[model samples]
Target chain A: MSMRRAEKQLARVTGLILLALVLGGCVNATVDEMTYNEPVAGIGESSVVILGRRHKPDYDTEFDFIECIGDHIHSGDPSIEVINEIAFINQFYPWFEPRTAPLQPQTIDQLLQLPPVAARFDEIKLEYMIWIDGNTENTESTGSMSCGIGPGVAGCFGFGTWGTESEYEATIWDFTDKVEVGRVSAQTSGQNYMPAVVVPIPIIAPVQGTACDSLGDQLLEYLSAHH
Target chain B: MLCFTLLAAGCSTKQVVVEGNFPKPLLDPLPITLGVIYPSAFAEHEFFDEAKGRAESDWLVKTGEAQVEFWDILFDGMFDEVVHIRDWETVQRRAAEIDGVLIPAIGDLQYTIPTHTNVKIYEIWMRYEFRLVDIAAIHQQEDGALSFNPDEHLAAWPITAYGKTPTAFLQTDEEAVNLAAVVALRDAGAHFVTSFGATPDIAVWLDGIARREQDAALSSSDDASGPQPIAQSSETSSSVEREPDSGGTL
Candidate 1:
């Protein structure tokens, strides 16, 4: 082959390799679900509430993840009504506050025995309450990038990578029966990359988003299933 | 020049004004007219902390508006009628018409940021001193039946509340701190409503009011049904001893 032809072939190979790397970043997610009681059928008129556990002093289940799960479940099944987290919590006020929220199904039953609390719950027609606990964190990280500017020229040249993990569990409770229905959990890990050659190109791994999607999908399946 | 400007901007004071809507608590109202006193210091409360290090920024957090709003809603929901008094003088002047008076003051306020804790979170803590004044006692003094003494007709207690917000989604430290403060204020309101009339001092004070009302009702009633005992408020009221107001310190 001629020199010009060889150069063109080498350029094509490099482009294909870069495209593959950009399209396929390192991401892994696992989802598990267990059911203790059968879900009630005909949930068209009932409502579900998704709440984040915030009692931990070190960390809290992020609100955005809860919202993501709500949105996903609603999208999956339009018949199921999802209540806004803030609005539902505010309607109940102190009973559902961080410090006073019921941590167990039995506690919820006792709270419901209160006339005022029971009246409000009846008004809302709540059926299912999902308590989400866990958070995304940077488990490990290595490498660093540096940028410098001198005289008339300025640019960045370095490479860095960081690992992130997200683990979340959704505990579903049957509000009408006051029993633990089931639980669905998702664990996800990913590595992010940054390569700087004059201009830094970041390849971000969607660790949290993947975890939310997996948990949401599993939760939707668990709720929709009867037996 | 640009670096100097950036440094100056970094050193500028961060002012956070807490703002949010506090919901009315769902509970049976205590059957009593309450006179609320919002001292100027409590109503216009602000916390200021100068940066201790070069990397830190000064914070001036104004929580007065939210404080007044939260307490107003809470008190209005908890009592049969809530009367906002401008000062203690007003409470003294109209002591006869009111059943009791409530005065809330900030004892202490503290906060933390992600840089300080290395935990990517912002937290705020508040201590509130609440004084429940017996209007009947004040009314007696006002009627010239007894000597006027400010400390003789009151019971005071302290409540501590805490709140925190994660910095993952927040774009700025000011926003995080503001959110944290709002959460803390809401927490304070929640604590007040759930624990009111349960604290040892406040419970005894409430029990005394209940007994007085019961006696008054029995004397004035021609029939058997005089108001029933407040279930939650008077449950443990008689069991606890009332603590004297020791210089208004809890």
Candidate 2:
């Protein structure tokens, strides 16, 4: 009986080890794998389509800025041509609702029908698409001390605390080949805001504006100079 | 037992992520000037006769008024940055003083009958082009073309709407084009400077110059990379001649 009990204990330990290994594999699989190809250089007339799933507050503001910049380009240069302006009417992603939505398949098909959309873009056109997901949820902790004792006495006891901050992830895909080219995941804490302010702050505000502005400026300049 | 094992295994997985950063180029502030290039023709359609008194009458009375108003608003917004040149001659004179030239060309302008209005109305469509000429290279580097069709309609009820007087329409078109020009110039100029500084070949050249200068500072060195030689040669070889401008007002 003693030997049997020892064997049973060993089996339980082995089973636990195997379970842990499998779970570890599962966790590792969740990490995203991003890759990019070499940059191509050439000069030719190209057309671009800016499509989005839905109009959110942030997106609307972004589009307004984009349109303003685009107007500048159009008014200034004759070689650069704008083909079409289209938008999708669907809310595909619920988790990041209002912030991001999935582009309707029909919209994509319709855009493909336009001659300018695919006329020059045989294999090399750059299709820019953005997907924003997740929300900021966080928790924190502190330490406390109390007096306790054995039997009839009390002794001092210290408490420890821990917490987590909410995080969100954004993925940008190049639809020319229907593959994700870049992904950025960021986390914001309550401490990021002003100490006295009660309002929650968005961590992406600075990044979004800065990245868009920089990229837009660069691309426009390149097109202007080259075209 | 299984749950405990799974949790333990999950904690052991380690992933190493790698990231790369682009090289940063040193930026030096240098004084730069830009010129303007104007297109010769102003008419959108070939059918319109320039000599005919009534050729532009209908357009000027209806869409032109709206355009003038648009230009006024645009100019008011950019009063601080842009220097308003009255005509092409002034633009050319100013262009000679600048390092580069931004020539805005009006590609198309039209007014279509409004479809939604209960009464007669018009929708103005304006398209313009911007071209940046690198004076030093004597080459056109960048061009951007865009159009705007403001959906707002002017009510036909007012007698001033059809007024043939220049006051009713001249400023509106000018304002819209000028506003568009200012934005285009600012964006294009910023882009050009950034790109020129960031180019790899240019960066290497600039770095070599910097390194040579640094060496000269530390040691008694003669002209190594020919520091002031290139600048002097270019300046002395070129004559500052103003080009003739013939484009009309926006």
Candidate 3:
């Protein structure tokens, strides 16, 4: 090929490669799904309330996970009642902190004896109450990330990968039985890669959704099978 | 390294509170069963950035749980009598359990640490918003009784504390932010103690009872020619009230 034609071919190839990298970098995804429950029947007409344990600096991503569970449950069984955390928790948000553990079975039992289902999540009959607790953390770290202008180099630079772990668990109870029923937990880990360059590109592995969905699906399956 | 350091430093959790022991309640320690609903915990507030002319969030964060604990402790120290923390929903569902409710919101939680070397001053401030609502009126409303039109039934106040420190340039700005919180909480608590009034219904109802007693005594004296009852001034009789419209703090 002539010099100009060869240069054009190289430009096309570079464009295709850059496009592929952009698309691949966009997917900083992680997931881990698990469940431990046998399905039962005669749970219809009863309601389920899903709650999450609250944390410092609550992220909007939390709602995404919760809504996903609610959505999946409805799709599985429209008749079954699913109360979102916000409607119940925010209604009394001052009192019922979100994502926190529910009152102990003893406390719940006493309150229910005096007045059935004192959680007051809703005025209806609730059989299943699910409490969720989880958070994300950096499991390990290596190398360093820095941004500076020295000699001929400028902008940002980093040459290392940082591992992040997302851990979560859900504890379920049958208030009707006034006993502990089941607990589901999930964890996912991945590394965020950063290559030294003029403009640093750090691939982040946001596992909040992954962990939430994995547990959500399992929780729904358990609820579905039991119902 | 500098940018990473800054980000790491910026991400933190802090509890803002009055440093020293809370002062004694001055006004006979009106010991009504007080409860706070959804009191702010340590977290970023968007308003802090709004005040600082920034659009980003997480710039100002607070440990709201600290505030909740501080309020619990401050009341324990300030009040000579019990100040119970009623379950938020129980109080809402059964309004009679609580004497009054304080829903608190916070602002200006972040410290302003200028990034540039030329800017030498760093400042921090916090604002507390208390929405004080009367329990009786809420009960009345819940009972389908005619509701008062924002009259003596509700009052809101904003309390703020400010602090300043020379640009640290290199040292952590946490010190300055914390100092500001201490000052803010102290000042805010004092203001709350002196200004927070009983629910409007209680104040108004009590005021009516006092006035009737005074009038009856005056009439009885006028008829029997009894020694004229000592003149009772309105300010001295009804000083417990802090209603804003009548030349009072709103």
The complex in candidate 1 yields a DockQ of: 0.53
- Best model number under DockQ: 1
State the lDDT of candidate 1 residue by residue for A7-84, as single tens digits: 775575446437536753668998888877656574768889999999999888988899999999889887778999
Candidate 1 wrongly placed segments (more than 4 Å): A1-24, A149-154, A225-227, B87-93, B136-150, B223-250
Candidate 1 global Cα RMSD: 6.8
Clash number for model 2?
40
Candidate 3 C-alpha error for residue A220, in Å:
2.2
Worst 10 residues of 3 chain B by lDDT: B241-250
lDDT for position B17 in model 1: 87
Q: Positional deviation of A1 in candidate 1, in angstroms?
A: 32
Candidates' chain A TM-scores: 0.85, 0.30, 0.64
Worst 10 residues of 1 chain A by lDDT: A12-21
**Every candidate's chain B TM-score:** 0.79, 0.30, 0.50
> Cα RMSD (Å) between model 3 and the true structure?
15.3
How much does candidate 1 score in TM-score? 0.84
Q: What's the number of clashes in each of the models?
A: 0, 40, 14
